[model samples]
Target chain A: MSRILVDNLVVTYPLFNRAKSSLDTQTAPLDAGEDFGGAHKRLVRDRRGYVTGVRALDGVSFRVEEGERIGLVGANGSGKTTLLQVLAGIYLPAQGRVRVEGRTTSLVNINLGMSSEATGNKNITLRGLASGRTRSEIEARRTEIAAFAGLGEFIDLPVSTYSAGMRMRLNFAIATAFEPEVLILDEWLSAGDAKFRKAAAKRMVEFVGQAGILILASHSASLLQENCTRGLWLDDGQLRFDGPIEEVLKAYEQDGNRLVGAAARA
Target chain B: MTPTTKIYDPHAARGVSGFLSDLWVGLSMVELWRAFAWDEIQHRYRRSALGISWIVLSFLMFVAGVSFFFAGFSGRGVESFVAYVAIGYAAFIFITGNFVDGCQVFTSSSVWIKAVSLPYSVHVYRSLFRSLLTFFLQMVVVIPILVWAGIRPGAVTLLFVPAVLVYLLNAVAVQYLLGLVAARFQDIGHLVTSIVRLMIFVTPILWVREGLEGARALAADLNPLTHYVEIFRAPLLGEMPRSTSWLVVVVLTVAVWGVVAMVAAAFRRRLPYWL
Candidate 1:
């Protein structure tokens, strides 16, 4: 029953302009004539004498149902994170429609999930409850997570004391521990070494094999090609291409090289 | 299976009804806040030798220090003055704690907010639970202080229960209000902090409200904190709270919640964007 249907999703974030000691970035204009009326008005120069918003996702729409392993490939600031965020219910769309019909958990930011002060064992409990899993579900997965994470005796230690790789392992294990119907991941897999990544990918594929959805946004081409069967390529906040993983990545890389080559000739 | 259609449209009409349903949904998830609040409390004490006991020790010290110095200044009997200040200061700190904490509630939880799709009110409840836990832990000292003041516990003392229930109800709404406001405007956080610090002087925690006159009496009357403190403090002192205090409490609660409904309707979704 888990499904995602997004229709013309648009999202915008304000650009805080500080003329003084802060870094001042230029205001990106809003593309007009979309279905949204009030959101289009937000980008006009305000009393602060600055264009207020950058449209992160502009009318990008797609749909996915149970058991789809989709890879999102895009450059920085190309709305990859924003799309995942909308799916995970972090950011509400400014216009259009988005329906997510299941329990979804996102590992978009690795630094965010675990409390550094809490022990790894406790974080699993805390995170499990936050995800609305039953107590028995959490207890059932606790040992398996420990074994998968390879934390061993380190599970009893506070997360603050662990190294970055250790935390990433724990986070990955904990997130995949209890099976959320829809799982969204960002580039957190890059934090681990190749062996850890291999083990994690095996777990993810196995998890998705059980009729769960996986939407992963990562910068690594190998990670996407190895795990995802489908791909979404985003450019400048627009959905540029969507198809088989190889074809999408091929178009995405060619366009990147084309832009760079054009710049060099200029 | 019912699909959860979460939508945002600029043209969608949001009024009081929209906010109430949003509040209802968030408030229903009690399990989320309980786990988060308990984790937060433990997180606060991590790596510290004194651990959770510091909450008790420091609260007792604050009550001893503040009540002792201000006891003679009130021109009231020392024991009664201790009792008044103890109860009044505890209430003052609790109220202001909610005010200050509510302002930073969302911004502080920006990490979790971005990572999870948990309801915004979960943060409000989490902050409220932590503040109430701390306040309750500190309020434990009030019992022994009341004994030291020679005040006998009676049926009237039970009034503290209802007063606190009202206090908590107002807290959820107020926290939602300030958390939204301060997240978008960073300056408001400092403004709220300074205003709370100034409140200690204007709200009559250390001094007697009964003896004031002229401008001083007017300040006490106009200050809403005066009524909030009295409603909680008056009960523990074994007297019925003044009818004016009850009226002010009820009226302010409604007014604040009314503002919350409007603000939530307009700004709740935009709040995450602002942060």
Candidate 2:
């Protein structure tokens, strides 16, 4: 079976301005009885000017089978978005490896290189080509894509004139035009009014049906339950759990409540 | 008998070859670049009655004003001063526009950079292409005037070819380094613009290099913009560039800045968070 494997992935970010530590004391002089005034002053001075790194992804290992739909659930700082970016080949893993088996189209930011000053038609061509559609294919499907966006009169108007919802509609339409073997979606898909939302959801489901492998990162558990068979739970750059969608969702809900309760208690 | 055909999967593990293939896919994003260039041009001239011709008109007006201004000071004839100042100003504008705009090449598109999975080099290339398009448009305004002034075109004008390529390469290097630094520092973007403004006067754009005094001559020669201006002007004006000096500048530019670019790209993944 075809699959995508990410082995022991680690992404570390170096802290900028390491010298700020040394300079901080210079900016705000330590008081005589402050923490630095005690025995800890020597330790603080010694540690200054040394680079510290934040581990954004730590040994994230996963294997996604072809044609499987997976939901990635996590908190704000969790590695869900990072994992999707790594799979899309945007960010290289600092350690380990990622191997994929098909053409991937990431809907991470549907309007990713689209110019606001360009027309909807222009953005359609630009976004479509970026998503891996050939020029001929984009030309062939131009009408259908424009119609899908439902911005008929405004198609030729600059996208800066288009409302936020209208732009998102155009982005969603162009992104879904090309069939991708591996499809990745970030949280930006949940825009538009009720009517447009229904249309977008239907189109998303259709795209996922044709997608060989799908990974979606969203905070909405209900959406995951409806779309994904498997779920991966991430927390603080670590894979906390991976299992059937229902099982992981249940654990996630409880874990979220526990954190909320602890905060309330404090 | 029915034949079994294998479908090509772009995601398959071809190792380093796969990465290179993906890079090729990224490089094929020239359509995106063209679209952005069109967008920039359209946006700049959107509401104007003169429209895109204003790009040419403005450049012509600039050359005219500077030509007259410098002619009186240099004690040169109107014809020769116009040619010299026009060529110098035109080349300087192209080089500085490319470099200054390139400083925020990625930073200006921070949203897109954070969102897209394409190669970071695409942004640099797009900025360079847009600047080149504007430069070409302005050259249309300058070229006819040069021809009318009896400055006949020569084989030296061909030097523009390699000169443009080197300028673009240097712009890419600068963009890559500054893009990362700007992402981190945030203040560097404003600082770059200020430096560009200062560089305009010091680079001899409105005057001949020979008109400068001793200390000024030494300073101008040390300015990277001097080498770039010489590279383009030497050929278009039928003069040979100082090969040794130009060579040193090119080598230093590529080597010193090239290493910084590699380091920047190596750490580019952290940029989104830093920004």
Candidate 3:
């Protein structure tokens, strides 16, 4: 069974000052009291008053079980990606307990390691190997991936020549090619035209219907509502709401509107 | 029971076992790094008419030009001097290449590092393999030089293989050490580039180590690089390497790995955040 349990997770990432990170400027001028606004209140400073790091995820907790389709809604840099990455085992949380039980595949970024200079066919080989596929395994699925992408002759050409929609087709096809008990995605797929969309929806149904887990982060309300039964709304690295998709999306929209109104008045 | 469940905790570390497992996993994924390294090589020379011959061409140019220019200064026969320059220079290139490549191995692969959850040793092996490929290519010219200089393969020459294995062994440790340090601190990258360039001169690639009488001799003796070079060069030239060189290299390998184990243990989990 696919399951995820995260408890009181805290992830703090270091933020080195530009001058301090540069080779020429080893000893940089100190920033004594540089303050950032809003969500950045979680930034940590050293005893010497220099900004040390930012608490990307602070005390966030969630649990996921089989057959649950979760839609994560959050503003940019609100730690939606970080949470997804943590689940994907890319970044380990600094202080927390996380247990993931399943073969988890994270398509967190569509173009995570895509090389523009390599052909669509070559990319399939590259991605397959990078994700731990052996030569024979990649060869077994090469033709299937090419047919799914529908790039045809362009599969032999470098990705640089492919149209944006075509590139997305290849990326989506390659990522979703393999089946997994748990899959994480950064955004909902809305690639190509009606035919591709129909195929993608079918693929999604097949995976979600297999007693697996799907955690998707997207801004589109309709997409989330159509595919996901539950929602997780994150605000500034904190879980603001978790419930039915309708209620979570409602709360998220209201918060956005309230912030807009507050800004207008100021 | 399902065998697929995996747990990751940033705060928890398994110390030596974790490091060993990581190395094992990365080494097992040979196809991953090998494919990427091959692709990188193809991209580098894909458009050129000479293709991968550029490595061989460059090696030939450097060794030929240097040997001819400095042949009289070797205080040795011109024929012997030629092979010595060819082998010594190639070893220098290989050693220095590993050092320079080590600094960029992790930093260059930051995209993959952030996107995927693979062992950090993958990049280490990838960079080392790239250097190894170039070193193999440089050998194309070295063989001809050896043949021309009348050095034939003998039982003593078999020692060259293990001497090279020692270098590769050292390279893995050095790569993990330098790759991690340089990724965390940008200044180390610059420092490494400078030190690598300085190493070219400090190492006796063009100059022979035979006639140095005083401090020069002591410096050569102290330089671990001199030992590494001697271990490889002495065997290929059908001479036995000094026991001191072999002892220094083995001891240094253990010491460097000891340091790498501690550093990697402390910072392996923090690698993603730093990038």
Candidate 4:
């Protein structure tokens, strides 16, 4: 069984100044003295020139169980991407804890490690390896991925020669070729040509069907309502609501309209 | 069925074990690093007509040119001088390549570092393997030079393999230490390249170590790089390396790794943020 439990998770991004005066500038500057040390003394918040950290996820916490397809709804900079990255094991949290079980496949950025100069066939292997697939595993699924991508002759051509939609098809196919226990997606499958979209959606159904846990972040409420059974609404990096899809969507819409009306009145 | 929990704490593993654990995870992904290394080699020469022959061709020309020019000045035989320069140059390229490019290993892969969940050592290994591949390609040039110089190897020649392993280990330590440092301080990459360039001249690559006498020879003996070069170059040149050179290299390897462990323990987690 798969599970994800986030306890008071806080992720901070340190903003470094142009003059990086914190650490020694020479060989293996190993946290010598003042920088990133000092357990008892509090960090210097504001000084002449020092690193400043931004709290991207400010003490947000949630639990995700097996077979729960969760839709994460939030505005820009509402920590949706940050939450997904944290779950995917990309970003390390600063102040709290995150526990994730089972093997995970992240589609947060499908084009994460692609080389445009390489052909689609080469990219299939490259992307597969980048996503933690072995050579034999990627080889076994090579034909299946190619058939699903339907790039045909273009698979032999450099990705630079392909159109944007074609590139998206290759990326989508490579990502969805294998299913993991936990699947994390940042957005919908809104790429490729019209005909390819139907095939891609069919592939998504197969991928999602096998996944024990699915966390999707997107702006489209209809898509979430159609796919996800549970919903999480975030406001300013805080969990505003976590409930059934319809109820959370209703509450989120009400809150958005109220803010818009208050702005209009002012 | 019951659910399993895997807690990921940013500050969980501290000190030496943290470094070892990360190294273990990165090394576990050997296939990934191999693919990355092969991809780099292919990408570099994919458009060329002769492909990796360019490495051999260029190296051959360089060793020949340098040996001929230096033979005229040093009064040494052309064949022996060519063999010495070829072996020395090959070792130099391998060591210096890892140092100069290893600094950029993390910074160059910032995209993957920020997005992927793999160990940071994966990037370090990829850079090292790419340099290794180049070194192997350049080794093709050494065979003909050795054959032409009639330098036959006995049981002592087997020592060359172990010497190479030590060099590789030291390269890895330096790469990990320098990779983390260079990521935080961007200028360190350029600084490393400049230092390596200067060291190439001082460490006796083109010039023979015996040419310098007395106090000048002591200067070369004091250089750590001279010891590393001697350990590898001496065995291939059909002479067992001095015990002092072997001792210095072993000590240097341990010392370098000691520093690497400290750096890894302290800054391994903060590396992504710095990038």
lDDT of 4 by residue, B162-184 (tens): 98899789888899988998988
- Judged by DockQ cut-offs, is candidate 1 incorrect, acceptable, medium or high? medium
Quality of model 1 by C-alpha lDDT: 0.82
Q: What tens digits encode model 4's per-residue C-alpha lDDT throughout A1-266?
A: 68899999888777665343444334434443322222112223446535365566777889988788899997777788889888888777887899999777676765555666678998888778776777888989999888887789999987888877777778777777756677787863554455876686566566567657888888877667766889998766678899999999999888779768866886
lDDT of 1 by residue, A61-113 (tens): 88887889899998887789888887887777778878777677788887886
Give TM-scores of the second chain, every candidate: 0.93, 0.85, 0.96, 0.94
- Which of the two candidates, 3 or 4, achieves a greater DockQ against the reference? 3
Best by TM-score: 3
Task: Give the Cα error of residue A206 in candidate 3, in Å.
Answer: 1.2
lDDT, candidate 1, at A247: 94
lDDT of 3 at A117: 76
Instruction: Select the stronger candidate by TM-score from 2 and 3.
Output: 3
* Clashing pairs for predicted structure model 3, backbone only: none
What is the C-alpha lDDT profile of model 1 across B97-159, one tens digit per residue? Answer: 888999999998887788777778888988999888878877887788789888998898998
TM-score of each candidate? 0.90, 0.82, 0.93, 0.89
Interface RMSD of each: 2.4, 7.1, 1.6, 2.5
Rank ordering of all candidates by TM-score, starting from the highest: 3, 1, 4, 2
Predicted structure 4: clash tally:
0
Off by over 4 Å in 2: A12-55, A109-113, A190-201, A256-266, B1-27, B211-216, B252-265, B268-275
Q: Candidate 3 regions off by >4 Å?
A: A18-37, A188-197, A264-266, B1-3, B12-14
